[model samples]
Target chain A: MHYPNGKKNDQTQKTLANVSKSHAFSNRGMTLEEDINAANAFYRDTGKASIHKKPTPIQVVNVHYPKRSAAVITEGYFKQPSTTDYNGIYHGRHIDFEAKETKNKTRFPLANIHEHQIRHMKSIINHGGICFLIIRFSAHGETFYMPAETLFRYWDDQINGGKKSIRYETIANEGHIVPFHYQARVHYLAIIDKLYF
Target chain B: MHYPNGKKNDQTQKTLANVSKSHAFSNRGMTLEEDINAANAFYRDTGKASIHKKPTPIQVVNVHYPKRSAAVITEGYFKQPSTTDYNGIYHGRHIDFEAKETKNKTRFPLANIHEHQIRHMKSIINHGGICFLIIRFSAHGETFYMPAETLFRYWDDQINGGKKSIRYETIANEGHIVPFHYQARVHYLAIIDKLYF
Candidate 1:
C-alpha cells in the first residue's frame, strides 16, 4: 500500500504535526471567537439582547466543602450539548444559534459540524425560529452569517449526492459577510435586521 | 408589640407559608410542570414547536465514574437563572416566554417574579422578538397568555405608585387564555397565531 510522504512506519510525528496545525493560529491578537463573545457580553449588559453562552455541563461525583461559603469541585465529567452555543430572546423573538471558527481557507468541511447540531437546527427551523451558523475563517479574517434555511438546503443536497462540503466560494456567494464594528464586533444583529426584520 | 394572627417572629410561619404558597398546587396527580414537560416532548416528536425547559443549572463540585458508562454526581449546588423558564423558536419567529403558575385566585403577586427576569424580558422585547408569559392559575384550571409588553407596563406602574400586583381582573381583561389541546397541551402557539400572525 502507498502512503503520503509525511506518513512513515512511526505515525507519531505526522499525528503531532496535524494536531499542532489545528491548534496554531496566524492571527496576531484576539481571535474572532473572543471578539464575538465580547460583543455578545456587551449586547447583554446594555439590555440590547439577552443572549448567553450555555455553561459547559459537567457531571459531579464528589465535592469538598471545607467551609460554609466555599465548595470545591473534586471530580467531574463533561457532557455533550443538546442545543446550540447561544440562545435567548431578541426583539421579543426566540434567538438560537451556534458559532464556529475554521482555519481552512478553501472549504469549510462538513466534518467540523456534528450530526446532532444539524438535527437540532432542523427542529428549530421547523418550529418557526431563525437559526444559523456564524462561520469565521481565521486564515482570511472573514466572517459569514449563514442562515439555517440556506444551510438546510445544502445539507439536504449532500444527502442526494451533491457537494459533500461547503466551499469558501459558495459561502461567499450565499452567506452574508458579517461586518465588524467597535461595540458589536461581529455585528450579527445588523444582518439579523436585514434578514428577519 | 403586637403581631398579626398571634405570630411575633419576623421569619414566622406566616412568612414561610407565603413563600411556599406561590409554588403550591392543589392537584395531586403528576405535577402540572411534569405534565407540561411530557406534552412538550410529545409535541417535538410529532413535528410541532421545538420548546424545551432549560436544564436546571448546577455547579458541580465532584463526579465519579465507577464504570466506563456509568457516571455519578456526588456534589452540586443550584444556580439562579439569568433568563426565563422556557425559550425556543416557533414558526419562523423567535419565541421567548416564561411559564409561571400561581395559586392565588384573585391576584398574581409581584413577588412571584424576579427582577433580573423582568429586565431580561424587557431586552427581548426591545429587539423585536415575541415575548410573553404563560400564567396558569391552577385553582381555576385556567392559563393566560400575558404579553411581556403589558407585563412590563404593569411592572413599571407598580414601581411608580400603581397596584402592587396584577389583579386577576386585569389579567382577564388584557391577557388571552391559552386553550388546552390534546396534542399541544399548552396550545400557546395558537395564542401566538392570534396575537402575532
Candidate 2:
C-alpha cells in the first residue's frame, strides 16, 4: 500500500480505518481484528469501555534523517509481545485479553498462543483482573469467551502430555458465546458482564 | 548507538538499559524514563505491580520481505500516543499515568501534553481507575504526583486564557512528592498507598 505524495501520514491507521469502513454494512468479510477495532471504537464513543489494542512492538536497527523534521526507520523488525495485545479499564476492573481467529472446525490449537502469553494471563487473573481469551471460529462464524481459569486447566494438561488442542465441543460447553451486534460488533463485554460484573 | 554487523536486536531498548546502567551508581544522571522503567521492573519482579510502559507507536509505511521468515520495516514514522504511556493493574485496581521531565527551573509547560491525552486521562479517572501525572523537576531533583482531578482544574483554567505553565511552587503545594529509593527508583507506589489504598 504505497501512499500518495503528501499523504504519507497515518497510512497504517488509515488503511485499518478504510478496511473497517469498506465492510461496514456486513461483517462476513471482515477480519476478527477489524471487528474488534470497530467494537472498541464503538465502546469508546458510547463511554461503555476504554479498551485499546497496543501498537505492535517494533525494533528499529537503522534510522535515516531524510529531513530535519522526518526520521524514517530504514531497518526494523517486529518484536514478540511480552503481554496480551489489548487491555484497559472497565467499570473499575482491569480488563485484559487476547483475541484470535481460527479456521479450525474441530479443535483450537494451543500452538496459537505463546508460553509467555499464558504466563501473563495467569498473572492478570491472580491480580484479580478480568482476563479471558476471545476465540473466533471462522468456520462456524461463532466467537466464544473462555475465562483464563478455564483455559489454564487445558494449558496445564497440555504441559502434562495431554491433547494439544481444545475440542470445539469443550469450548462450547465451558465458554460463553459472544453475540454479534451492529454497533458492538464482537460484543464480548456482554459476556463479561454476565461472567464477572 | 549503531549495532555491530549481525547484532541487530532491541537496539532502542538496549540504548535505554545502557543509559540506566551507566548511571547506576547515582540517581543524578538517570532520566525520568529510565528511572520509571527501573521502578516498573522492580515492581514486576517483586509481584507488587504488573505495570508496563506501552510501546512507542509507529506508522509503518512500507516493508521489505527480503526473506520468507523475516520481514523488515523499510519506512516508518512515529505516531503520537493516544493515551498515557504506562498502565496496568495494581492491588486489584486499574492504574494509568504519564511521566514527564522538564528542565525548566520555575514552570512546567503544559505543552508537553496533548489535548486528547488530557481527555483520555479524564476518562480514566471517571471510570474509577487511579490516574495521575508524574512530573520530574530536574533542577530540583524532585518528582511530583499530580492527580487527574488536580490537573483538570489547571487545564480548565488554561482553556480560559490562563497561564500556559504550572508554577513549580504550585505543583509542590498541590501534588504529592515521589520519593527516590535504591530499588524502587521513583517509589511512586508508596505515594499511591498514602493517597489511595
Candidate 3:
C-alpha cells in the first residue's frame, strides 16, 4: 500500500518484529503508562478526580472512508506532543503533570523531558495550575512527585552548564514519594492532598 | 489498504467527490475550526489564555519504519473522541468546551454532539471545571456561548421527548452572543469574562 504522500508500507515485516519484542516486554509486567491509566480510571470511577491522558498526537496525511465502516487513516506520522501527558481538575484547581519512568538508579537524566514540555509546564505553573512530574525509578521501585518549580530550578541550572541530571538523593529529599495501592496503582493524588489541599 | 479490523479503504474514490463539495463551501471563507484556531493562537501570543484543541484520535492498525524518516502509520481508524474538543487552564480554572457550527437557520441539532461528550462535560462540571459549548449559526453569521448547565437542561429534555433541537431564539435568550474581533476571531472569552470571572 502507498500513502497519500506516496510512501510505501514496505517495512511492515521489520516493524512487526519490533512490535512483538515490545509486546513481550509488556506481557511480563505493567508499564508506567498502564499503571497511570489504571490510577486515572480509579480516580474517575470513584469521583475523586477527572484526569485523562491526552491521545498521542498524529499528523494525518490521508484518510479513506469506506461505504459502511468508520474512516480509515492510511498514512500518518506520530507528532511530538507539546504539552504534558495528563491534566484535569481537582478541587476547582487545574491539575497538570507528566509521568516518566527510568531504569537509571543513580540520577534522573534531563534528556528524558523535552524542552517544549518544560515550557508547557512553566506555562501551567504561571497560570496558577498545579503542575508536577511523577518520576518512577523502576530500578528501585520508587516513584516521586516533583513540583514543576523544583524541576524548573534544575532545568535552568542545566542551561547554565550545571549537572545534566538530578541526583537520586536530591529527588529523594525534595520530591514526595508517591504511594502505590492495589486499585490506585500510582496514588499521586494522596500526596497532592497533603501538599496542596 | 485495510485496517487491522479488516475494514477496507475502498470508498475513498466515492467520498472524494463529497469532500470537494465541502471544500468548495469552505473555500469561500474561514471555517469555524480555523477561526477558533486563530483565536487560540492570538490568546497564546498575548499571554491572555492557555487553551488548545485536542488532537484528533487515531487508532493505529499497522505502522512501518523504513529506516529513513519518521515511522509511518500505514493503517488506522479514526476513533470517536470521548471528550470535548478544546480544554486548558484559564486563570486557575479548568476550561473545557466544544465548538460546533450548523447551517440550519432556526434550530441547532443535538445530533451534532455525541453521548460520551455530554457525559464527559457532566463529569467536568461535577469536578468544578468551567464547561460550555460554542455554537455557531453560520446561516446567520452569529455565535453563542451556551453554558454546560443550559446544555444539560436541553439534553435531558430531549431524553424525555422534548425538542430534538434548540431553537435559535432560545439560544439567544440563554447563551451569550460572542462578538467577532479581527485578531481574536471568535471572542468567546469576552463573554466568559462577564459570565465566569
Candidate 4:
C-alpha cells in the first residue's frame, strides 16, 4: 500500500503484507486510525466513553457531480488543523489525543509531530484533560498509548539535548502497550481502565 | 456594513460594530463565527479553556493561484458539519456549545440549527459533557446561554404542546445572560464559572 506523505518505511527488510501472513491472523486488517475510530464508536454506543474523531478539515476547491448520483470532490487543499485530532468526554473527564502509525521498528521519530500540536497538547494538559498519543509500530504490530506528560518530558528534554526520537525500549518502559482485538480494535481504553480509572 | 456573504443588514442596529471598538475585542468586527474564534483563541492562550470552532468543511473544485502572494480559492462548496461548533475542556469538565446570533427581537428561531447538530449535542449530553447554545439576539442587545438539557426538554415538549420558538422572556428566565465586554467580547465563560464550577 502507498503510505501517506511524511511517512518513512523500511523498504528493504519486509512489507506489511509479508508480516500478516507470518502472523496467520485473518483479522489482520484495518488502518490504525480506522480501528481506533471503530473502538471509539463502540465505546460511545455502549455508554462507556464518548470520544470522536474531528472531521478532517479540508478546503475543497472543486467538485464534479457527474450524474447527480455521487458528487466527486476533485480539487482541495489540506488546511492547517487548529486543534488536536480526537477529543471527547470519558467518564466525565475530557480526553484528547493525536494518533499516528509508524513503520520503524526501533524508534518513533518526533518529526511525526508538528510544533503547533505540541503547544496544543500542552494547553490540553494545563486545562486538566487526559491527553496522550497513540503510536502504532505497524511493522512489528505494536501499539503504545503514551501519555502527554511523558511526551512533554521527552519533548522538553529534546530542547535540552535529549534523544531526537523515543526508542521502543523507552516506550515499553513508560507507555502502556495496547492490545488488538476483533471488535474494539485498538483496545487502549482497557489499558485506561487499569491505569487511570 | 455588508456581511461576509454580501447580504445587507435589514436592521439598523449596530451592536457588533460598536462593540468592536476596544483593542481586546475579538474578530476585528468580523462575522459571529469570527468573534467566537477570537474568544476561543483568547481562552486557549490564557489557559482559561480549550474550546475551538471546527472549520467549515468545504469541497473545492478549482483553485487558481494567479499571483504568487495570493492563492485564490476559486470554486468551493460548504460541507455539512458532523459535530457541534465548539468543544473543549474547562476546569476538568467537558464543555460543548453552538453559537448563533439572530436579528429577531421577540423570539429565537430554531431553524438556525441543523438536525445533525441537535443530535450531536444530545450525544454530548448523554456522555456527560456540558452542552448548550449561545443565543445572541443582536437587535435586542442581549445574549443568552441556554443549556442543551433545557433545549432538549423544550424540543421534546414541542411534540406534546410547547411553543415552536422560545420567547425572549422565557430565555431570560431559563438561560444565563452573557455580559458583553471590551476584552472578553462574549464573556460566556463567566456564566460557565457560575453554572459548572
Q: What does the interface RMSD come to for each candidate?
A: 13.6, 3.2, 6.3, 9.8
Give the Å error, residue A168, model 1. Answer: 4.3
DockQ of each: 0.16, 0.55, 0.42, 0.22
Off by over 4 Å in 1: A1-33, A44-50, A54-78, A88-95, A103-106, A126-129, A139-141, A160-164, A168-174, A193-197, B1-28, B58-76, B103-107, B138-141, B161-174
Q: Residue A104 of model 3: what lDDT?
A: 84
Ranking by DockQ: 2, 3, 4, 1
lDDT against true structure, model 1: 0.73
lDDT score, residue A128, model 4? Answer: 85
- Chain B alone: TM-score in each candidate? 0.80, 0.88, 0.87, 0.77
lDDT by residue (tens digit), candidate 4, A1-197: 22122222343124344544453422355577778889988887777887888875764444456553344454444566767788888877899999888878899899888888999899888888889999988777788899999998889888789888999899989999998766788998888788778
lDDT of 2: 0.86
Question: How displaced is residue A111 in candidate 4, in Å?
Answer: 0.3
lDDT of each residue in B4-56, candidate 1, tens digit only:
22422343455445534655573433345654676677767887677776765
Where is model 2 more than 4 Å wrong at Cα? A1-4, A7-27, B1-27
Window of ten residues with lowest summed lDDT in model 2 chain A: A1-10
List the candidate 4 regions with Cα displacement exceeding 4 Å: A1-27, A59-76, B1-29, B58-77
Per-model TM-score versus the true fold: 0.69, 0.90, 0.88, 0.78
Interface RMSD of 1: 13.6
**Whole-model lDDT, model 3:** 0.84
- Tell me how far the alpha carbon of residue A187 in candidate 2 is from the true structure, in angstroms, after superposition: 0.5
